[model samples]
Target: MWELQEVPGRSKILIHTANYSADVQGCIGIGSNLAPGGWWVTQSRKAMQQLRELLPPEFDLTITHYVPEYP
Candidate 1:
């Protein structure tokens, strides 16, 4: 998940996705693979749960939008 600070109330906006785009409006997608149409995420819940456990309650999350290449 990603977050942006410096806003008015300093609220922590989450960047997570549900099963379909219709379920979440303009929200970021999370999963191991893109769905068939490439508009949805395949394993969003699993990905989110894993992320949630790893993150601390209050902390800064920097989003670089970087994708690592594998050998």
Candidate 2:
């Protein structure tokens, strides 16, 4: 697992996958799309696989918070 460094008051944070957010614990979950109501993410395994192919073994990740405006 890739460990996040320099996060305040946090350690061992990783980028992982799960079918539902309920299955995740204090870690980043990677998914391709949101489920019908946006409660959970879908295609997590596929997304992870794609990330594995695209990302280098070691690289820096930037996390950004984005909220879509829905009319």
Candidate 3:
């Protein structure tokens, strides 16, 4: 499973497991799956590792929703 951590900055965002956009909840989710349900991914840890490697020592992440919200 992917772990979500809060990064301090303009906003506190999450870094976690999400294969599809629907799985996201104001937090980031990374997974191999291109579809929805359970945020299931083949290699979750490896994906997280790759992300860590690609980013700088310290970085800020922002997550935005593609869908519209209704109150």
- Number of the top TM-score candidate: 2
Write down the TM-score of every candidate.
0.53, 0.82, 0.44
Worst 10 contiguous positions by lDDT, candidate 3 = 1-10
Against the unseen true structure, what C-alpha lDDT does each candidate score?
Answer: 0.68, 0.84, 0.58
Model 2, range 1-71, lDDT digits (tens) per residue? 46678888988888888777776788888899989976899999899999999988899878888999979
- How far residue 63's Cα lies from its native spot in candidate 3, in Å, is 1.8
Q: List where candidate 1 sits over 4 angstroms from the true fold.
A: 1-12, 64-71
The 10-residue segment of model 1 with minimum total lDDT is 5-14
**Model 3 CA deviation exceeding 4 Å by range:** 1-13, 17-27, 35-39, 68-71
lDDT of 3 by residue, 3-70 (tens): 33554452545566555556666656765444444535555556777877787766555556598685
lDDT of 1 by residue, 1-71 (tens): 56556655646555775777776565466676677856666888798888778877667655566887969
